[model samples]
Target: MKNSKRWGRRVLSALAAAAVLAAVPVGAAGNGKSKGKPPASSHRYIEVQLLGINDFHGQLNVTRKVGGREVGRADYLAAYLKQREAENKNTLLVHAGDAVGASPPVSALLQDEPTIEVLNKLGFDVGTLGNHEFDEGVAEMLRLIHGGYHPATGDFAGADFPYVSANVVDAQTGKPILPPYVIKRVNGMPIGLIGVTLTETPTIVTPSGVAGVKFIDEATAINKAVRELKKKGVQTIVVLAHNPGVSNPDGTNASGEIVDIAKNVDDEVDVIFAGHNHAYLNAVVDGKLLVQSYSYGTAFSDVDLKIDPRTKDVVAKKAEIVTTYHDGITPDPEIRALVEKYEAKVAPLVNQVVGTAAETITDEQNESGESALGNLIADAQRAAMKTDFAFMNPGGIRADIEQGEVTWGELYNVQPFNNQLVKMTLTGAQIRQLLNQQWQPTQTRMLQISGLRYTWSASRPVGEKVIDIQLPDGTPLKPDAEYTVTVNSFLADGGDGFTVLTHGTNREVGPVDLDALVTYIRQLSQPFSAQIEGRITKLQ
Candidate 1:
């Protein structure tokens, strides 16, 4: 009897799903319409605009000079978006992902609450999840979406918009952490939106940030969600993925992993919005539109989709990459006020003098492969942990400590993730293996180091790159010798494609990396300054 009941339920479900699919035209641009001519006035088309941004990273008060124009700050973005949307009545403002994470002192210090409030006021309809969304862990991410107080940082109102991720799921329950998709009605047309993040999210972020959640393949997740949305009579689909883009100038023929995913996804998906590489791209792939504005609130992607009223399917689409310049654009008073509230709150902690820099430490690395800032950080880590040696990832150092007094906020911006120092033991050979790992997967940045020096031939074959290794005193490195190595928690967890670090044993974790820098800087007898010392020599 139970078996019979289950079978009956399946049959009923199939019938209902079929009815839903029949109600909506769920295929190509003109799915249910004749291809002969334009529809009549009664079946007129409505142009719906999609205003998208990605990797905002909570730059409420930061600015970047792009193309010789100073731009950015959440206020400028709000003002420009408001002006643009004013011209188009039917518009939806959305973010691809990383709206907040690895932010500056102004936003990061407040746990990004102010950014959320500003986004809410900005009228963000919906957004996706980037790997950074998981930086503070899933619980914090959930808190950011729903109204609640942080366990450590008091209560506050939360986001007005929902953050969806079709790919992020619970391992045990096999259920998504958030809603897989959201349907928004624009100009009387229901647009289905599915959100996805890079499947490699775990590899990039701190391991604890995404525990118990599984990030699945982007294309598979999108195809599945597209099918479900189609069955619900929602045909116009867009995917917000937190993946890097293979950029091409203008909106024609840009190719990358996103393009590959677009090609594999079902035809029902009309657009792809992406983040993670902080790039500006305008491309059409798989007969669909894909875009990503550069990060830090400096740019936005404006896409227009013409929907046929008769079929509710997207018939024509065009996209442009818009740079957000502060010139001539007045800051939205509400957003500026919102940013100032947080800015005022963080002043005391951020404005404290940390240390001094006699020489300007730039992020630009020398030919031998070391940046002054990177060397200083690596030195600080080694000093703080009392390790035999320490190495820093090139990506971790976000800003340069100028030749002046480095404030606490400046130090925070340099190592904003608040990662702790991890000391572990590795065989000399394993250390070499770690060096070789840098060249893998196409990113060949040598780590910023302290207490050791090595030369690797870039022209040499992959595995045998590191030619000579020695300590600072000229003692030769022995493959059989075990040595104490220090790295940040991100590296110890094998982040940034350095899986070899996971093998290290006898782990001893210490203070946060930024804190280590703070203490190390204060202890410097002179203003803390470092120069690239040819620690990592790459063959020309």
Candidate 2:
């Protein structure tokens, strides 16, 4: 019953043609509502299906298309999970992180109430927190953690599951913001779940959103959690880490921060369910299964684990990633209804045509961290404030700008966060320092730039990276000359490990980033097309 690779999802005994394949006897309990322990057998191996979703980002609608087929709709996702569960006796559903934040208006405007409500209905047991989870700040996250109706999105009973984060520390109390870990009983086996996020969280997230919080090392946090869980007599452990590795489509060799963290974590940890970078991968690192599903509700990871009852340990494991296609699967009626109800509330605003795109500008980054969408966003920020130049973090661009009519939904997907533009002044030397600040030991902060041009050598050390700097008008930058600049408040406050941006003087604030994009699109008399235009040249 184990599906070995990251692909290979075929229902073994799917009776219904419309139902997603599951030849294996469908479990009545994958939603964490049914008892999955084997019948009193002393030496039986209990088969369990662990369904994982990561980086959902509140995609309730069926908007993203693959080969002209609608995939990743909330209803379709629900239907797939339901059908898959019917085949396995024991099952558990969990999310890695980023369930909300940078989401569409249908979910974001309601303050992500709809997102939380739908997840509750799906019956998740536990989930971790990603950087986006703190977009609205700790107070709003608390509102999501404990059940109650939110003022903006109205009624939401809150999540049925606990949000765990062992690494996120509260600055005031110097303790983990949420529960470090949670233990769930699947059948009779005590399954311990440890959650953690990248310690670089502060650099990527808005400083204000995470004002009083600090993130600790992922490996250290998980090891400590493992020691605590072992003391509770739990033998089976799963690490739901919000930090992810670079996407390797083949599921072969891959390396990133998560890879390093995985190599260093205690061997007591079993599978690592990762997120935050929206990568789809499944590979064994240090003999531990590491898996991730592509983001935006477009895909999910289906992992099957066999636990030995006598030894109380995982004996066998199989993992595969499944795309949530719409045609062959039946969309859950209840979830579809829920989506319609929430979407109706924001229809007027979300349906509006904000702009048009003659080409598809995606958020995917290059080796040097350049993206066409990032460049477009930077251009808009500079245009909005009429500054000498502007910058955008690569992580800020969420989705691609598809061809044809650009609706508010598409723009919202791109700039989901309501970050305001901050205009300021900095000298040429300070700007060079900003460029040099891009290279961290574990990260490269390639700020998408506009109204200026620069070249960098990867072979060069951190402080000596930037060379041949010039303004957009082809004027060479003078070391002592100061120029007006515009950036998001996040970067202005030294977000994303770039401190040079914070040194700028004459700070000024502008409209929200989304608003600027909407206004920029409306003003365009023709379809807008984005290009790299040699704005950034990286020499490896």
Candidate 3:
């Protein structure tokens, strides 16, 4: 095994620099030209292109629609990356995280090894973790990155590239779990890449996923890494952060956690690639360029930097968010074959027809914060657990059930976390408090419900938003009355900030959530459907 300390010790060999020019998308900031004025004729700058993508989520065989154009799929993403790499040999391919976990069947079924293999084939230089990377726990994550044995897929070669995360550390040791940063040389100048994931990881991931690790402040970890990199004479620094942020289509009005991180980090940090929210962001704050591509391989961030070779610092930087539209380029045949191989391997189980939807049941929430898909899944869990009510976090419902036959593969995509069902007891008042938590200061997460209804007031205070709660039979929920409640393992453990769930008693673990959903669909009459039944009401 390679020495863990040596992970970031090697300095990459130098590469020749070249000019990069690409057309900018509409509503973005960069003009497809280098940003700064030309350097003195005697001072030639080293141009390095950083190609980055975030929140991939292992959509190996999935295609998504962006602005009416069919995009995504691993092969197409590979083609786009390869084309961009050819434009500048000094380019470094990097990802901000969520490369795996919550993945579709093609990759998830094989334990996400295919995603790692694809990254290896594409030659990813450096990467960082997103919350989803901890979905199955640290051991599984390391197995996917550094290679190890898995019962389902046998031995694996793991990731070819190094993964750096300064913030995630050992719970007992209080030391970084991986190299905090990696250094690469371009034109004989050292460039540092530091990594950090959101500190809210513990709350978002299942307990076991982060069993022995603790996440610290993103900026603190970053600034400390910066000091270390500076001591080593590295001036040009980039951060690969699995944090959230968003910006207007024109790259204006940027705000999110990453924006706050950018403002606080050392000014020597030249660029940050953000992720987790899976949104488009291309803006400059605190003189540092920050960018994020919309997730699922549909887009990528192309950041160009002009590094002053003598001073070893980035003097000029600009970025453009590029959509992977399938209008012109052909998908890479080799990657397509790789995807097909995995697909065929899992076909027998995933391709089985589970049920049919009479019409599209989407996770799109209405003004009342209710969705048909969420209702369907919540009803399934409630029914499976024989509970009085069930609540599903909106984020857990990943995709829509379109009009037509629904396959196990499609269902797997909907709830990929494999969280088991938890049946517990909660008082009616406790349920009300749970509903109120949907409107927290940091986030507004509406919980999808089954077998009950509630009205919440927007004008009311955060903890008092829920005005009333009642059973489906029109019986008002009694504050002192106890009732059974059902939620997936994630929520029962207080994931997504639903801390009220943790107070529940008499918890009984049930089948995997996907199994409950599958059984519910199977036992239903053909062409069965679910809809918003006024389960949630919003008052202005």
Candidate 4:
């Protein structure tokens, strides 16, 4: 993109130096040069508004409760965003990432085309990729972004907004798959936006999702983009980083991957928008403004920058994390209509009653890392495959089973990845090894199991955490004995770092996870309830 007009050449005066001292975070002001001089009067200070959202997992018709207030839904989010955009003539809408994957039936059922369509209607200016965007792998991601034919969705026009990522690159060519940055002019002042996702994407996403791509260091890529942008005479810069960050409501004690990136990047970079943790953050760290709104359509980040026209540098910046409370505004009619269209199309399958829940079965784990919903899902997969045992990854369980009248859509929401269940043979020793893999150095990912029980001690080392494994018949697991095991395609392929699964033999793929869940629920007694059953034990 080209700048609308060239900025007048000027050196920073004492006033500009003062603004830099006041506006820029401590130690963040560059080496006393290239700082922009502020306009003489307050009226000359150009107010540019940047509205950003992140981790919107395509809840087109879903509403969520935030702080006891009902907030969210595509149409309501659109109304709030549009209202905020109208408050300033110089405004841009952007997203950090995860706009599509792990979505509800309304969008995921249609290949997430409706999510992109709604973002198009809202006129998003730029975006970056989150780990979820890579859930289906690179080719499909590009198909969603650049418009291509899919057997499910047919011909499609992709996102109108540009997707920029400074770090993600093709493995073979070692070149960025998308542009590193995009420059957009607001009121004739150029603002450069650089995008990058977390380098840990590979660990969280299914292995196939990140195949043939590599995510380099976020800060290194960002600094490179800053140098390139500066060569293009762009003084103002913002980063859309799909990395996690969090701070208190008062903007104190900032921490996370994004904070590190902001500190390491060039001082000329002004604002950083963060995502992936799905938390609230609006803090000034290392002389840069960092902000992230909570995930879904629940909230958004409103960042305003005061730019000096002559110098085209950000002179002042502030941000507000706004919740999309439905109380104050009417939903946008156009987006509402679009959402209804998709919802109606999916209603036939989504609304079908599969079973009833006596009470909510939540993904909330106990001290031993076992959850009711996780147990339910693992049992379902095991039943579908007729396996001796089954393991379910906690991340695969997305939502709670609300009390009464469970629907196909609800089960779909709970297991949206549609991974086919795989029955494989693993020796008892291998099962113990797989259970121990949960305590990796970076994080713990406890697997939910069915037809077996195990105890783990936090005091044990990473690879030796499992104290004992036993079958339901009270027989101690024997190392030499091979047993049938079931897991989703993601786990079978070693997703979430369960590499031991890759060693399994005699693998047979069965029904998709959602279908297995639906079938299991349908056959259950009415008003079924699942609970923690002492499958995992913690050492005191």
Error of 3 at 391 (Å): 0.8
What C-alpha lDDT values do all the predictions have?
Answer: 0.79, 0.77, 0.84, 0.84
Taking every candidate in turn, the Cα RMSD to the unseen true structure, in Å, is 11.3, 6.6, 6.9, 9.4
Clashing residue pairs found in predicted model 1: none
- For 315-348, candidate 2 gives per-residue lDDT tens digits of 8887766667666567899999999999899999
Q: Which candidate is the best by TM-score?
A: 3
Question: Model 4 over residues 34-99: C-alpha lDDT tens digits?
Answer: 123334664587889999998898988887664445667999889888877776879999999989
Model 2 whole-model lDDT (C-alpha atoms)? 0.77
- Of models 1 and 3, which has the larger lDDT? 3
Comparing 1 and 4 on lDDT, the stronger one: 4
Pairs in clash, predicted candidate 3: 27-250
Order the candidates by TM-score, highest first.
3, 4, 1, 2
- Across residues 1-540, which tens digit of lDDT does each residue of candidate 3 receive? 000000000010000000011233322221222223324555588888899999888999998765445768899888878877776778999999989888899999899999999999999999999888887889989999899999998999999999999999999999999999999987788999999999878877778889999999999999999999999999999999998887765567889999999999999999999988777678888888888877888777888888888798988888877766666777889899999999999999999999998889888788999989999999999999999999998888777788899999999988887888999999988998898888877778888999898888888887998998888888899999999999988899888788999999999999999999999999999897888878999887
Candidate 1, residue 280: lDDT: 54
Per-candidate clash tally: 0, 16, 1, 1
Number of clashing pairs, model 1?
0
lDDT by residue (tens digit), candidate 1, 114-157: 78888899899999998788878888888888878776569977
Residue 190, candidate 4: C-alpha displacement in angstroms: 0.5
